[model samples]
Target: MLKTFRWAFAVTGLGLVAGVLYDGWTALGLVAVLAVLEVSLSFDNAVINAGILKKLNAFWQRIFLTVGILIAVFGMRLLFPVVIVSVTARLSPPQAVHLALTDKARYQELVTDAHPSIAAFGGMFLLMIFLDFVLEDRETKWLGPVERPLARLGRIDMLSVCVALGVLLVTATTFAVHAHQHGGGHADKAQTVLVSGIAGLITYLIVSGLSDFFERRLADEEAGGHAGQHSEDAGTGRPAVALAGRAAFFTFLYLEVLDASFSFDGVIGAFAITNDIVLMALGLGIGAMYVRSLTVYLVRQGTLDDYVYLEHGAHYAIGALALILLVSIRYEINDIVTGLIGVAFISASFSSSVRHNRAARR
Candidate 1:
């Protein structure tokens, strides 16, 4: 464990040192809190990522740890929120950055105010992921009673899409009525939710579809002229071998988008700690580093195969998060509460995995 996390520890130390140098002990304290918040909220993300990372070869895995980490740190942590605010509040990139640096309180307000749309898009994307997993007819069934019926329903073409659209429409309608009653921004938020949710759904379909298409091609090639072999990779739900060429590229894109969806809430919730973009990036960046490292470690160690049910737990946690995000559009949900819900699912799944292992031994 120590060997795997050596880089994370080193970078975390540097971030903490920089935090103290930037603004005394108070900034250091805030950075520590923010890092904890990020890690707590994102452990399940690491699990899901590991399941994908193992499909890539050493080169792409290195890229994930190196280039992917940079994007997660700078692109999502620092720049993405700026872009969101710029689009939402009609400010330019420079102006958004200026507002963040100069008037952090107002900037935080703008970012927070944009939460409905962010939640809509991210919530729908994540819901699709969870729905795909739950709806698939996998050999392993964690929640057999619930998942079994869902798998039967998966026979219906695009059942997951239909379910996702149904949920989005209902949620948007609920929010539209609530916003009308409250007179918050005159129903603009309802429209934003509907638009963003459709965007999210479409984005998921395109990216995921492209990734699966490439993976099928890769799988076909690996099967050696046996085009009738399999529609998708077996076992890991990714390509059988480490993907290369076009396959790796699309899969990598999918992983980044998935990671971004998970980070949406964290970026917004970090304002509860401090609105200083620099400190927020430094702290959450540290946590992201740890999450990336943990993912690589899981891929290297074959932990998922051993645990078996861990993936199910992570997906269930993701489903919970999706619901929470949509619900929070009309009502605020505490960050601590959100974090605990994920941790609970993961813990329960881990315990179940251990029991299954013990029974097999018997």
Candidate 2:
């Protein structure tokens, strides 16, 4: 615990120093606020992640803590917003970069205006996650008539890819039609939406597919081992090798997917606070540290096992966030409120977990 606190403080202190150097006191304040927001909002994510982490091998665990940080800091904080600006705002990559750096004020306005689309992306993604979880839980025979066929349609992994692609096509067409009806240039809008949506979808598909592949492989290995003890021992050596390979791949994919999911909100929300690229980066980067530390804390504390319902609560929060993101496409939802909802659910779960522990002890 002492070591963990030291690490958290060290990383936070580093972020503070970086913010001060990059954008001074104002940036520092923004970072502080972002840190608080991230801590509050990401408890649900931590809970969900804890459940996943328990299933992962030790090697993957280390990668999640280390490489995951890089993805959050660089991929989400720096690259993601640039991609959004280039695609939706019709800014060239270089121009967007310049706008973010030089015309920070106007850039913020542009990004804020782009919130609807960002929210749409997050909402749909979360909806997919929620739906998948629901399908996994319900054990009804009637649904199997419909689900078995879909399940046989090459796994949920493949289904997700198809859904993501379909969404990209639909979103691009809708945006293009809207642009044309509004007397704006439809070609640019169509191209931008198509390209960006495809890019995001492809990233999601690749990461999710890879993660599923590894998880399935691990399960297969375990199942095969239980079938024949003699063969299992002989196969044990091979299984260990296979397990290590799969774990490494899964860890990389998990971090990438998680970072992408988190970015859907973090990048959009950052615009609400500041548009200065440096300030936005500083603020969100600090927030990322807290999220990462929280992930580690969940792992170390075995929070999921201690609180059986915690994962369920986190998934519920994820479902809510997804709905909120979808609504934000047409409406404005404050980031503070989003954060609070997640925090409230997590707090309730924690209280429940404490009661459970006490009851078990008695």
Q: Candidate 2: deviation at residue 144, Å? A: 21
What lDDT does model 1 reach? 0.90
Report clash pairs, candidate 2: none
lDDT of 1 by residue, 249-354 (tens): 8888999999999999899889888999999999999999999999999999999999999999999999999999999887888899999999999999999999
Top model number, TM-score: 1
Which ranges in model 1 have alpha carbons more than 4 Å from their true place? 179-186, 225-243
Residue pairs of candidate 1 with colliding backbone atoms: none
TM-scores, one per candidate? 0.93, 0.77
Number of clashing residue pairs, candidate 1: 0
Q: What's the lDDT of the predicted structure labeled candidate 2? A: 0.65
